[model samples]
Target: MGAFGVALILGLNALVGYDLLHQREETLARAREDSAAMALVLEQHATDSLSGVAKILAGVVEVLAVRADAWERGDADVFALLRRQATLSPLIRAILVVSADGKLIHDTQTLEPAGIDLSDRDYLMAHRDRLVPGGANAVFVGNPVRGRTSNTWFISMSRRLEAPDGRFAGVLVAVMEPMAFRSFYQTLPLSGDAVVTLYHADGPVIARFPDHDSHIGLSAHHLPLFTTLLKQARAGTELLDSAGDGPRRILSYRASAEMPLAVTVSSSRDAVLVPWWSKAMTLAVADLAGTLVLAAMTLALLCEAGRRERAMADLQDSERALRDSQQRLIQDIAARHRIEAELIAAKQVSDAANRAKTQFLANMSHELRTPLNAVIGFAEALESGIFGQMSAKQTEYVGDIRKSGQHLLSLINDILDTTKIESGKYVLHQEDLPVDDLIGECLRQMGPLAVEKGVTLTAALPGSLPILHADARAVRQILLNLLSNAVKFTPPGGRIVVEADRVARSLRLRVSDTGIGIPAIELDQVMEPFHQVDNSHTRRYAGTGLGLPLVKSLVELQDGRFVLSSVLGRGTTATVLFPPSRLRNRSEPLRALKRAQPAPV
Candidate 1:
């Protein structure tokens, strides 16, 4: 019977796992189909958008062909025709008329110089050097480029302007802003991590939703997604790492029917599987509960059968032995009952404590924030001299009051955050975030603090680093707290360094300070909430002692590790390590910034 029970349980477990797996696959398949549909829609929209510009360009070409003499005479009506075309198309940034020799004759935006040369432009060069066979009205879509006149990224579309004698006259070009395409993408019902990108066949990204200005004209040659699309058929779907932020995603792309541009739409695996995982977990828990109940029933039946067998043996032998067996069985049963009762009581107590803790934290958060907010607001008003200021002493007093209020507000906010984390009310909004950007911003914000404290600060970030899949706000807070503490403790002439390096399958960020170092014995205690090394009411530093504890909580929430090491008289180094699972390679290029050296206080 026991063997049969074990076999049944194993079979059920396998069946449940297989069903969940199947459901998850089905969900992913649906997401892929959705992404493909979205890609097709985007492609059509892009075609229509470009086709509209092409029509406007075609109109200008015909007008110029019919009125070549008017153009030569600098006819206001001809220039007005060009301006009208640009006005009709809001997406068109500018319209330029370049002579056959590549010299600009007229610009819809300005008429400063008729001799300005645009021969160096790709669209001009393409139109001047080569002609499409048997297609005189063909529109050439140039690569995404920055125009010297506008100094903004645009997609240039040009049509060959012809003379009445059928010879080429000049190139009539219309520059379209990438933001026009981005606006269309924003209207799509895409997940937060879902990305919609429009890129040229060769490499440059024309427009992308969730865009970075720097990536508008950046090269995407290193991306497998683009390279694979270039090799494969015009339209297809595949699982690939996102070329923008390195999350694994299901990407569907379709090349434009008219242009050399491709529209790619991607949905992140995490977003697609979120609802499926929730349902799967629920079913899994239910299955586990049922399995436990079955096992318990099986054990009870087995025990009863053993008890009956013992009774039969005792009855056939002696009464005394039967009585002894009965007493031992009773005692064992009573002990088991007592242990079960204790377990039930302990569980009840734990549940009650948890509820109480959650309630207390919530109440304290609301109550404290309300009054602290008022205090800070009033103090700010006084410091700003909204109420007329009197003497120097009065101004100084107001400044002190404002500073104290601000400090108190900060402490209150930290306490609320820590309480939320401890009570399990804190949630992380995880996404692909550029750690380098966050690091740079943190250093900038902490710069003034570091200088005021007479501490030299430096940062050495790699030219390239993997983007972190984490809560950006939490990660920023962690860095700010660490850097703030470093600045606070380090004395005059002391140096603080913030650097990041890749280790094995993880990334490590270290913040080291030449501060009054912590004692080795208090290292573990320092991470405890509200437990400072100098646990005195009149401590030199102003803090609530929740910085390290809060940092540790935030790091662990993202499945990362935080470690602190210090010597008695030396400095402290705080290291935050993120596992490989939490680190993703970035698809987009980053602007190179120089490594910072220690700045004198």
Candidate 2:
């Protein structure tokens, strides 16, 4: 009886505790919803206020652009017009017209002359330097600054005033007092620890509730909230530690669509849980009283001895189950460890095999080149009669030997270059070289091959081309490889063109061929070394398939970009874009090329 009573009481306690916990969750959820709603209201208010201020500034700019003489002479009519616009919104502190040189020409605040130079002010300078376009119906918001005369903190927004001819004339300024926002936020039912912040797109805190002068002009760009604003989420919620005050809070933020700013409303986490805590305490006390009553009723009337026996059996069964689970977990961990060890050993073996292959290729390159060079040298001597050849058959045989040796050497060189590029040991010699002359040289070298293949090769160059600060040899090689492939794959009656044109921030060289073009699905594979396009049209062409891949690597070494596009049976266009930093003017003097640092192996 006693054991049964104890179990019943314990179960009752657990049920009550769970119910209370569920209620606590529901209360907290409601509070969070309320906070989000209030934040939304605040966000809308801020957006409307700033948007109104921007519209007023736009109107002021229009007026200033038309009546420049009246404003320059400090006309009363202009001052009255500015005063009326400033008084329309309580958020605005002052409206002034400043000249191109940053001298205050007219003011709605006061007529007294105060020596103020705003040329160095960020907002004014931003307009002067053309950082923001003039007369775009857009406003430029500046960081918060303290007024010298009033000693009050203010954030300013301005619009550029342009002349009739679209030249910059001056700026129309509208200063907003942060205190006005603070005063409005004070009416909201927010806790003392709660914080409200407004961030300019450029990272400064433009306004804060429960306003602090020290925080207004500070940059909060490092905060997670600021970064979130940069991503331009319309309205979202997160829990973060406050940037100014270090309280963890549930912050709801919204970004302005019409202005370059964001607003965040944060509430303390502790305050949100206050109602839940109160309800939990009440439920806990009631549960304890009920448990005591129920336990007392069954204390003496329950079956104690039999209940104890069954409880002992259950405890034993639970222990056995726990032991089995632990054993299974241990076996699983051991199997995982073995698999990991095998994977590591396999990776090491694979790496070793790759190293061996590289070493063999390097050795074979030297071995083959040595004999090939000797064979070619001797054949050239016999063909030129330097070895005193007597018969016509000997002359023809010598010619064949020379051509065979040269072909073998070219194949070996291509393999070596591919190896070097793959091993990351490629180097470049960069210099100022005429782009036009480079194109001409490549054409001259490929002229005979083009004629033999019956392909029309031509250069489409602009009248004057910019010189490039690049590796002359690498540039020549890239052109040679591209031209060679074009002439090789193109049909006898096909056309190949080498074109150069200037693009924004880069110089582009395009080699287009009216040959059997590559299929769209196989474009990516064509840039892989030793992989050719798999199609009937490409089967007849003979190549080692390293030309395009080598060209890509060489262009990248010079800090350039390579782009390839092709449509089957239409054409293939290969473009090399060298960055503008590598472009030199036509008059640039020739200088020695700088050797590029060898790529890391």
Candidate 3:
């Protein structure tokens, strides 16, 4: 067939979808009626099971009430008749008749309801309003305890009986086996693959037909069909449509007059879709086969046409390749221009860094002059008594002024030292020094500040550690900056532990603290110049944050690597590892000592 004819047939095929859903809905509706009628039939059996027991058992109660009344009125002949009535029935576990005068007049099955307050019995009390015709039809079945009427707790029914004048005389109460009522569920026809659910009208599953016990006594918790049926005021079947991926189930129900329960039957969407789907699939396969045949014939013509077309395309492609080669040469020239632009950008960055370095040096010079002037001026004032008589506060404040000046001077020197290191103009003063003593010296400078903060300062340098091929002054400065910050951040009672050991050709000095540690993300930023973590509040702690950055640069100057590792809120550990002096000749220790150190007091 041509294209239009095939499309027409396909459109006709699409029209079958409605008939399919209609046939499906109708077929499902028929199935529902059969099932519903079956439900109705089963419902009658259930009613028969309940009502039949009511009639036969009610007759037993009627007979017992008559003889028990005779016994209460002192008629011995009628008492013998009641004995026959009670002992004759086997399903009746027990029988008792209580009189209006609060006396248990008769009993059978070895137990007698005598000398007990029958007036207090639920049967007697419930029957007191029996002047109304037909009395209340609601019945209660309970298990009463054996032997005592007041201590009663066994499964039995209490039904109100009437006198011939419709007077409330007594009650007809029957004690039946607990299993008798449960037999209704057992005798119903439940498909082995299907489930039969008996639930409380309030929607708790009371029982299930088959095992697995899935629904038994469960709060019908939010089953969609169960909820929907409650909203609707009738009994009907719903086949959940699944073509749009909604619920794919079939449900039907019967509301229980016994309780608020609705019994629902659910079937898989696949089960219902099976018949029509097969029919549609057969048509689909025919259409696909026809389509494949058309495609094959069309493909044969297309391939023949493409063969001639490819020859022309090959000739054109050869000509285009030559033109493209020439075009690529011009594009390469443009790419070279981009590379040159990138170089210019890099040169600008280098120039900016150079200008920053110059500004930093000017700042350091100014920083150095202020501290030197203070120390000189404060010492001169103290020696000459320029501020008149000196009290403790006067002497103390001057000492602080001088001390502050020196500390600023020391920081300024570290900045200058880092500048030299970066310029490749810095020299290492390698020495045959006791690495343990150098480590001890660093700890001694840091201990008082640590003690002031209540931080424990300790060291674990091996006594026989090898000498390092490092500038001892640079090492000390680096350790000072690291330990100062460690103790500064460490809260009161925290510990700062300095540990070192020679590993093969390298000596590793590690300064660790129990402090509010560096954030892992921010640790890399700490080595950048002028960086501080929360500098606004750190005014309480001395030193610009340049200390660690300076230490990093100094360590790198001697071909040593400095690494920092920290767990946030716990502590930081800064480690410096350098090659040992044993690896360098004595003559290699060049003169490079510009930073001044205050003598150990």
- The C-alpha TM-scores of every prediction are 0.49, 0.48, 0.38
Model 1 CA deviation exceeding 4 Å by range: 68-75, 111-115, 131-134, 303-601
For model 1, residues 1-601, the per-residue Cα lDDT tens digits are 7887687778878999999999999999999999999989989988888889999998887777776443552344465567779987768987888888877776777634356567788877776666543367788888888777567788898998767787777788897889988887888789888888888877788999886476788878788756666577888888877646667889898888687788888888888999999888866875685466446545645776665454445434554555687799899999999999999999999999988876786688679878877877887787787888767888788778877876776777788888888777898887777777778888988998788878998888888888788887899899999998998888889999999989755889999998888988989999998888973422778787899999999998887889999976679999998877777777744333323543332
Candidate 2, residue 209: CA error in Å? 2.3
lDDT, candidate 2, equals 0.79
Q: Of models 1 and 2, which has the larger lDDT?
A: 1
Per-residue alpha-carbon lDDT of candidate 3 for residues 295-401, written as tens digits (9 for 90 to 100) = 54345345665654554455466557758977998999999999999999999999999978866885676667775986768765894578787887877877787
Q: Which of the numbered candidates is closest to the native, going by highest lDDT?
A: 1
Q: Model 2 Cα displacement at 302 (Å)?
A: 5.7
Worst 10 contiguous positions by lDDT, candidate 1: 592-601
Model 2 compared with the native: what TM-score? 0.48
List candidate 3 segments past 4 Å from native: 1-356, 359-377, 380-389, 535-542, 580-601
Task: State, as a TM-score between 0 and 1, how close model 1 is to the true structure.
Answer: 0.49
RMSD of 2: 16.8
